[model samples]
Target: MDTRDTACPPTDSAPVQPKDFIRLIVEEDNRTGRWDGRVHTRFPPEPNGYLHLGHAKSICLNFGLAREYGGKCNLRFDDTNPLKESDEYVQSIQRDVTWMGFNWDGMYYASDYFEQLYQFAEQLILKGKAYVDSQTAEEIRTARGTLTEPGVNSPWRDRSVEENLDLFRRMRAGEFPDGAHVLRAKIDMAHPNIVMRDPTMYRIRHTPHHRTGNAWCIYPLYDYTHCISDSLEGITHSLCTLEFENNRALYDWVLDELDAYHPQQTEFARLNLTYTVLSKRRLIQLVEEGHVDGWDDPRLPTLSGVRRRGVPAAALRSFCEKIGLARCDNMVDIALLDHCIREELNATAPRAMAVLKPLKVTITNYPEEQVEWFDFPWHPEKPEMGTRPLPFSRTLWIEQDDFREDAPRKWFRLAPGKEVRLRYAYYITCTEVVKDDAGNVVELKCTYDPETKGGWSKDGRKVKGTLHWLSAAHAKTAEARLYDRLFLEENPMDKKRHGKEFLECLNPESLHILPSIFIEPALAEAAPGFVCQFERLAYFCVDTRHSAPGAPVFNRTATLKDSWAKTERAGLAGEG
Candidate 1:
């Protein structure tokens, strides 16, 4: 479990007429005294897998509305499908919602209302509103007509109420095999909306549920279980994504038939983020087939994945606010999300130095056995964050990419005979470059000026470049996992648009691991979930999943900015 404690950063106060349509509805409902001015919403997630980024938008909206209005929101698991659900997924959902910084007024499960939901189904049957269907699952799908056609009614649609009751009871008694029969609402066969064409309410499954162990053999479908559970809890508003717009009619049909308390089912467009896939089926395939690591892989879009990648809860909330709510679905640029993360981390994370690719530099003029300590501020702009002691010595490690043997006119970094300021230490001039047998730059020999003690000269001499380095003898070795976007295309899920399967569009270079790296000794003791900036590099966090007492693994959350964006601005060709 993550040890970081967080709160849902407070949203700005609501206005006279709210900007978004959903808020507008809530405002009008309050003014009209709907449900006696009580506002209640619920986040009902199916516990078949872990929550992903798409679900974050819904979680924020549902819980945020209740919070702003001083109402209540419930965290309910729609665990109707026992075959794919498990306790692991249920626990993960709870942890994620909490990590996102919101607590539920009440926690619940669809299984808790099984008896009441079953009774409601019987009530509909007694009123000639639903019946038992004997068709196979495929046959039922075939009969459910398309946009231009009418569906063929099931032969068992008109079964006597007494007979249907007996069959349904038998289903609960474990008298039928899986897929033997399904209980469906007897809606119009010729309805224009295909979802209303006699949808299934319950199906027989002999599998034991994670919660309600083998005492029964039947399970209710999601569409049927969701609305009834909301009504039973007296929810005033049932918020769902736009994909459920067509299902709204059926949601109302079930409650209206039972004469139960009905919550208005409002649908808004779901978040469609770029450069990754969020569909449950695709995510499951990615995990099950070993296309990625686990559910919490930083490259994945799952909330656990992003959290492990060092995305703060406050930044996610801010991103949600910037995007707001929309009636129509559109792709949101992932860059906006990166911007929010950078904004939050830059203000809070302390500054540190790390070398992903180390190249040794021996200061020829400095005493080999001597060591000095330099005072480095934790943050340049935030003086209150204070300072830490960093060791300076004769031998140190700098980034391999920082030095160029044949430097360009625009390059200010290290090169043969080039002088550069060592950050927080002294000025060094590279006099020699040593190469390995393969002609790779192995080491650099440099000389430091005694007068330039604190990275500056007593005389008014200026250096164009400054480089970050760590004392070779004092620095601790650790691993750095550099992570990037998981997909190459903006809309990876659009198979036709990409001319390949979604999996084929996956980014092969999403993750590059540097097995060994050097960081200042203080960073080795950083607690899991601690975030900081690697000066001149990127924003990183001590991985909560891998770091322990003395071992730390850092995950790069984002570069100073996208590498390409920086390259375009600098008008340079290679790494500097």
Candidate 2:
């Protein structure tokens, strides 16, 4: 199936004021003097992997809400897991967020609060609210019973407060080996919420941290560290995905026990797109298994990948706004994303002529050494965009797909004995078809009608088809990459239902590279990252990483036709 045809059709209703449950809650909080009417939020991401579309939504929401309320938002790195976190991921995250046109008021790392976090842990032990557990990892998991049954109390749950404090301090001092002992909150073992059943507050990890190298051997777990970080920063609202809804109980318990400044936590549905997997684990696997080029491979859904593929940041922001915030999760059709990209590019991208699969055509009747410069508008409707000079001569190149020796019944494009307009030039008729030794039609000999200058017949004759072409003498060679959906299945991660491995659902033809493409000479000077529409082809961008000064490599962004619009039109026609 062509997944390109799959789309979540947009409604025709007029735009309404943006109001979601989270917004309503924020309004109520302001009315009730929550956090003293100060609005502060943070985008806390773990620096373990590059940010993806899912993170983009959170970034927009956190930053967007803060901006809407005239508040401040901080960029915080949840660098607690040093084993997997690195400086590369940190730099990429900052670059991605900045590229999305957001500036944080402050930047921080969770490791910066390690000293205070340890002090808070000691405070828990002294208050008899937390204790050091000597049980193995498996033992703790086994004791944390199923949803239907109460968990069993740990054998070391009754340790003396002084002993627990000494053990925790020793753990911090690097006197204990990894996993020898862990600090757990002294919450009820029989609590209905599993996350509150003596959750681990700190664990011994001898690994060196990227930011704070060899500073401490003990590290605070995410659940314990996140709340303290939020409270320490005086955040008014802690926004997170719905998976952490149960963890909210534990978050509240830690803050309440320590009597720290509390922040209200709100959960919203995360972005889940069809035919794509946003899980960091799955993405990492794809990279490690060589299923993709890298984190920024245009095929992957990573923000870097999407950016490298020439998706404008404005388009992404507009898409997030259109999707809005919802309480329940749903699979967003990838076509909507394509629609957003096409809609944005259609208004802004300049027009250029490119032949992906070139077929040579010789104007037999035109003068041999003559070269006419025809003016073409950069954007037809947008006259202010101006125009560029297009060279027309005896020899030219047209798209191979634009010609057919044995034409179909209503075909209007170039064929034997057929006359068509050469875009802004005169009308031309194919006089003879040139073939190679293997009978492959390699070229066409055409005769031009000089009376029909500038593509309009002076004698009131009508031409049904117009084709974009470039003077062979003035055209430049380029490399064009045609990219498509990375995954073939609508839900690549549906292993149980589909009975197929995620890798098995990978689309073999996701990327097609055309090494010998021709474009107009005006585009030869096009700099890296310059985007334009390739006439009858797709919207493309000059590859920033590969393009040189005099040569440009283009990456296909999206096709001109909107598949989602087609689907919608088909549905409406059926209803009629």
Best candidate (score: TM-score): 2
TM-score of each: 0.94, 0.95
Question: What is the C-alpha lDDT profile of model 2 across 1-576, one tens digit per residue?
Answer: 121212333455765454667777777788898767889999999999999999999999999889988899999999998899999999999999999989999999999999999999999999999999999999999999989999999999999999998999899889999999999999998999999899999999999999999998888999999999999999999999989999999999999999999999999889899999999999999998888889988888899998988899998998887777877777888888888999899999999999999999999989999999999999987999999999999999999999999999899999999999999899999999999999999999999999999999999999899999989999999999999999988998898878899889999999999998999988998988899999988999998888897788999989998987688689889999
- Model 1 lDDT per residue over 52-147, tens place: 988888889999999999999999999898899999999999999999999999999999988888888888889888898989999999999889
Any idea what lDDT model 2 has? 0.91
Model 2 scores worst on lDDT over the 10 consecutive residues at 1-10
Model 2 misplaced stretches (Cα beyond 4 Å) = 1-15, 569-576
Instruction: Please report the TM-score between candidate 1 and the true structure.
Output: 0.94
**Residue 162 in model 2: lDDT:** 91
lDDT (C-alpha) at residue 137 in model 1: 98
Model 2 Cα displacement at 521 (Å)? 1.2
User: lDDT of each prediction vs. the true structure?
Assistant: 0.90, 0.91
